[model samples]
Target: MSTETSAKAPGGLRTGVQKFGTFLSGMIMPNIAAFIAWGLLTALFIPTGWLGVEGPVEALRWSGSEGLAAIVDPTIQYLLPLLIAFTGGNVVYGHRGGVVGAVATMGVIVGAAGTIMFIGAMIAGPGAAWVLKMVEKLWDGKIKAGFEMLVNNFSAGFVGFFTGLAAYYWLAPLVKGLTDVLGKAVGWLVDTGLIPLASVIVEPAKVLFLNNAINHGVFTPIGGEQSTEIGHSLLYLVEANPGPGAGLLLALTVFGVGAARATAPGAFLIQFLGGIHEIYFPYVLAKPVLLVALVLGGASGVATNLIFDSGLVAPASPGSIFAVLIQTAPGSHLGVILSVLISAAVTFVVSTLFLLASRKRDLAADAAGEDKLAAAVAQTERNKGKASSVLGGLAGAGAATATQTIQNVIFACDAGMGSSAMGAGVLRKKVQQAGIEGVTVTNKAIANLDGTADLVVTQAQLTERARMKEPNALHVSVGGFMNAPEYDEVVALLLAQQNGSAEEAAAEETATHDAPAIDFGAKPDPATSTATAEGEAPEGATPEVLTRDNVRIHAGSATRDEALREAAGILEAAGAVTGDYLEAMKAREETVSTYMGNGLAIPHGTDAAKDAVLGSALAVIRYDGGVEWGDGDVATFVVGIAGKGDAHLEILQSVAIQFGDDDTVARLKAAETPDELYALLKGGLA
Candidate 1:
């Protein structure tokens, strides 16, 4: 059962929706903890809450002070807006933008009389930050040397003032109107028994990583308004109902095979208790058809809530079952619990059918006999080699032959840390047990992969993306990251390759005919290769690109630009490139910052600035303090490249493969001497 399926919508519409969803999710996801805190506080201390007794008991709630409710109320009213503002601003302009965003949002909060101005904050925050960014761009290079701070402060303050005014005068009223309309529409849907239809959008959006946006941005605000009017709001149950997700996972736990069955139980706990919806996202993605189960489950849960007239007094921030119960109305506990059970039952039945069908298909394929299956697998392996060769446009025979020795293996995923990390650990253990030497195993975010790995393992849902990022690597798609069967298959393939290499060596020794030797280490000449070699550096380029003098063991640099210059200076000193290369590298940074996650950054000049390169070379600088490369990503190692053509790509690929290994990355970060770093790098390439 191939995990790869067409789940995304066709081109333009999908791209637009995805971009908008990502932007909205970015604004809310980072502040989920704050939201959860607010939700818990509201659930515990509000008048309708279990512990929200009035009179002397209320005074006891805070040791005879105004009461814990006093603190919770103000935090929800004030802190939540500030958090939304800061997150929106940070998304647009970083820390400075965050400040401006918060400042601008306060105006809307003060202006709006009844509403909390949730949507208003979203608008004012990003708007204020964008204005500040534009003003900074206009002042770039024009500001007097000693007065940069003065100009920047005044410009930001000026933008914030106007933004605040605009929010008070225009944006606040506009958002209030929109919020009221949405709230009324949602209330109508609930009244008419049509709220369950929301599952059509919510289920798909959740799978697309937009759960936070829909919950916090759209639903939470409307739910809050409705809850204020009534004692509780069914809108809160629309997205936060954990029943559907819990049901799907329960089914997987019972009937799923391999990793799905093993991980589902733990994932269920996390999803049901921790309120992390992301735990079940990969499961649905593994089989897009399971989306039907999710939607039906969600609808059933909503319908059950409708039947019982159950509602929550506040939003369930993590959408955890605990949060749902805590926020449920005083007399609605039984109804809420029943709703969850019903949803779980519906999802389990549907998912079991899908699982059985998938299993049957796999069994049917396997029944084709061992020899036929082996031949098919071998053909698939050969196709992968050909694909790699096509991507590199190198000598086809050399590229195909090089696949025999799998040096670097990477397991890539959407976020890189969760399933991919676990998968990489599993593979690493298997490789060690099998006594595979000189092989690097690692994991990375699919977007950050640099096409340097010999093998790339990823979820079937992300296979197309992995192919795009690392076209030269052999791609392996699996249903789940924790699948023992898939890992066993991978191990068997590696063992077979190793044994095949030994047999080939024996055959070569006994052969009577003379054959030309292949040199895998020699750089491919771009001029002789196809279009795939368009950017490749010529053969016989600089032999000593990275020298001892260019290596800085422990460097001190405060910012990304400062580190870039320091590394570039080393390349200049080495006569690899002229000083003009620094500007070229900076210019490239403006286009796309080279901070490649995992504490590594590769700063290189643009192709247009090839004239600045005297010869191909590299500079390695390590910062113990770690320089911030924007967006909270910090880099300990800054590699500056000054390659004239595609010649430098090989070195970049080697570095990528090296960094992919967690052990190597950790050792490089802890390396005490320049020699140690160089040795690691050299050994990785060799």
Candidate 2:
């Protein structure tokens, strides 16, 4: 789960565009080094290069294909695009997909001739891989054991052959035409002198975390092509300029209040020198009025670059002053430097004014202990609907001062009915009992998984689908509803995050630290636990829904059918349900497998057959070796339920939270008698 994203996102239109942008970036970000090498070669060895003094290197210029210069054109023309295709294919499937993607991209490169096939690869690479994936699914379970290799090899060969042929004739022309259209649009923007107006779109989007997409995904391809044609492209400087962020941080440092002010100086260095523009987004998010300063400042920088006709030969990553200078085309130093200075001055002055206007309120907020920076960071993640690696640069956002907060937890399943509802009920009650605050747990069908959830919980079988639907939220998989066992882990994680030092939240393990304290009652020190006879049920097990008779230590079961029948027999023998409930359980099992994830299965009558349940009660049977529950699922514990009008839900709510801990589950599995197992469950829940 992205529990993420205001940048490439979880929303509708914005999400679609962001995901597409992220897709393109995924294919390109890994290959930036190659582009840099090409840029350096062009900058140093060509006739107009820094090394134009003339020598063997000079003669081996772009015109002379005998040396370093010879490597330039071929590198960009062949290697870079192919690498992107293979990477995209790999993301879709694996090595086989990569091999097919590359072969298909070769067709694109050849068909397009003089034009670089960046866009072509972007389409054909993933497209071919997707087709292969779909084809494989057609024969997924039907492949004979021995003939699998032969069928698999032939299928891939056919896919690659057809995919390559399709790209050569059809996809190449369509993509080249699209590239030409975009080139024309940029030309029109420049010719009309309206190019600087792009800052209006760029600045606000940058604050929302779209900088990488705008710079690398959209701008880089166009700018790289332009640079190849004319030595440098001003488009490269549009999004890479760090002046707007620098100016905002400076103003915040001089006039802002509280955490925003305290963090500004450190953020400034990270932005202006370190080239990490994301360091200052919280400043703007904390005070949206400062966006005016950002836009005007960015526009001013673009205007200066336009006037000076100055631009970098390659993309300036991190947008740091150093990177910009390193990639600066010859004779453009004064222009580039002036643009950065002027943009910073513009934003600083504007932001300082805004801070002055709100100084009184801001001071009061600080006095009240309001953490605007931290709040904005949480808001950023909320807007994104998930987590972002770039966002990790923010110190207090989750890594420095406070861990990222999780406010919304979603429990998702196929229909948002039965299983998921029960799981949510269990976790929600446990959360309330533990006095967890600022957290709301809700269930929704996987199909309705909105981007707002900070965390998503699903059955293992449904997890992949959930991720595809909402890639920005955090996702957790649980095996069964009666034994949700993952609920405790989720709660502990939330606790760690809420306390501001989510110990495991550190994506980069730069230091060692003590583990956070977990509050789940399953683990108690021996000193605090009451002693009892080894096989005696605890006093707490006297609850009507659970007792010594409700639990079994070891049961022999070979198949899912046997497990369900034995479980129903236990419930019947306990007087919790009439014999008619067995048919209801069978019907429910036939409709939907009772098997959950891990090693737990909960069997119950259907809603329409609630009349069969004589009263509210529960039964637990453990399998020593575990029984096969079909579709690769194994059930070590079968929990049979009989309730009057949904009373089993309450029974499940009381015990589900205690099952998530590994030690807790292990203790139940190791219990030597029904009394011991019953005692463990009742004691833990109590």
Candidate 3:
């Protein structure tokens, strides 16, 4: 029955520093810096005469003194909260439903009844738990466990919606009031203490090499309120060292390889012709050690620009080589070329060495059999059925048919609602996008659900339960349902199911067979245990998967603390965080839990187990039911070890793509489990 290639994860010295460093790179600065940079741009440029400028002529006619005056204006206050809300949301909740989700949620938080949304978020999980418990009492033992997750997760989303409302209405005012109070206090201190101290340090720093005329005068990639000057300096710097970027491109071609290498062509198409160099961001991120290299190269180019007294008369839109050439001082092409060459040479050597060393470490670790606990999903082939056609045609197709016999979806986690429900939302979006219709998806806690499913997807710890419930369902192990490839394959499988249904129906018609097509109602076992038959499943028992393609990982932050502490504060301030969420997550983690990998993980499971995985995962199995994946690349395989029950063989392949890859293996070995795993995954993904 076991097809998975069992291997232990690599165990070695934990690289805590590197892990934290990666976390800083991924979670802390990237977006925060962007927000700050854009805020300053909005603040400085809008107030200056630049806003009213008509064309290149007006833009070129700006007075430096006037621009400097507008740059420091205090009207730039509104942007701070926007950044905080967006960034805080992303950090806490990992949802980014575009500016709408963040901004609208922010508005709800700041609305007339804004505190409701915040309160709701605080109480969502706990309230959902209470609701589930209440529902459990009403339902019979046969269906109570199976239907628990659907009820809980739906409640969680409902709670979050109201919480967001509270946040907009009630919390915003309190926050604004607190900000004003803090502002006054800080102002008093700054006027009395900081201004004089800053005057001494700032004036000296400006006079010393920090603000030397050449260094200060040339363009730089300025950030904060001083960004205009920095941008101006950076413009000149790019001209001076055209070599650095080109060299980085060449290096990217070598290290990134595959789709990453193809970035060169994409960059060429966008940057060379289109003049958009933003295509380079992924390349920069993929090999983060090269970040220092890029910075050093940029500085070198800036220095070269200052040395050569290079200048740019016009703002370049495309930021391509041609754009640089056209904008640079006439006949300074040689300086540009030399600067680029030198910068590129420096970048190449530094980046190449870093990449080689990292790769070498990965190979060594792999050879030593470390981090193998997280091997790729075992590849296997099995007969799969399609019920889409039956759904498409059945006039009386009820909820049971919608759930058990239709599509290739297995909500096979311990506490299916928390993590599996979110994953289902993602899957539904993806399946819809793939043009597959008449499909149903639902989660079943391992303790229930007869074995009539197309595929039974469950966490590692709950495999036994899934096997017991749906021995007929083709079971597959994917550490967790939320990660990529697993979700992607689930979509593919649904699509295939629809296709298979069509083929089965067509073949039946051709052969003139009178037999009904794969009738779920006829199956005595599934019929007896159908929770949907009791009218419990969503929208008439049709559960859908949540996908990255559609479901947004909205932005937010959450503190590591007791649920009552976090939830109660938000509820008290906003009137929404009502339920006991920490208890819910802990409860969820206990049964058929979501813990999967060492440095990687996802906490989730069916609702049947005593301690459900609370919809998250990190280190060793958070609960007793969780597996002890001893040694060998445990860091990389954490997420994949959780949900071996709800997924199919293909999703396991997707886990391999995400966690079983070379880069993931190396990163896993170089990081701590749990928190560090989340950081590395976030960084690599971002």
Top candidate by lDDT: 2
Model 3, 401: alpha-carbon shift in Å? Answer: 33
Q: Which ten residues in a row have the lowest lDDT in candidate 2?
A: 528-537
TM-scores for all candidates?
Answer: 0.63, 0.60, 0.34
The true-versus-predicted C-alpha distance at residue 192 of model 3, in Å, is: 33
lDDT of 3 at 26: 28
Candidate 1 has which clashing residue pairs, if any? 535-646, 536-646, 537-646, 537-647
| RMSD (CA, Å), each prediction | 11.9, 13.2, 19.2
By lDDT, the better pick of 2 and 3 is 2
Candidate ranking under TM-score, highest first, comes to 1, 2, 3
**Model 1 local distance difference test score:** 0.65
lDDT by residue (102-131, candidate 2, tens digit) is 889988989888787888888888788778
Q: Rank the candidates by lDDT, best first.
A: 2, 1, 3
Better of 1 and 2 by lDDT: 2
- The segments of candidate 1 whose C-alpha lies over 4 angstroms from its true place after superposition are 1-11, 54-66, 210-213, 229-232, 253-289, 309-319, 322-332, 353-362, 365-595, 598-614, 617-686
Candidate 3 wrong stretches, greater than 4 Å: 1-71, 75-249, 252-417, 429-584, 587-686
Residues 1-686, candidate 1: write the lDDT tens digits.
21122212223544455556556656766776776666566555566554666322444343323377677656656787788888888666666777889999988987776786778878888789888877776656676779977887888788889998888888888888898888888878888989999999998877664455567677877876765555466777878888888989898888876445656787788889988776676667556688999899889888988888777877676788888887786556777888888887888889889988898664454455222222222222222211111112111112233354677788775534234544565566556566556776666666568767788876543566677778777766553232233455456556557765433332322222221122224464443221112222345743656766777764232367778888889989888888898997786565434565567777877545768888867788887646667534567888887764444444554454455456557777777888877766655432
Q: How accurate locally is residue 495 in candidate 1, as Cα lDDT from 0 to 100?
A: 59
Superposing every Cα of model 2 onto the true structure, what RMSD results? 13.2
Q: On TM-score, who's better, 1 or 3? A: 1
Indicate the worst ten consecutive residues by lDDT in candidate 1.
385-394
**Evaluation by lDDT, superior candidate among 1 and 3:** 1
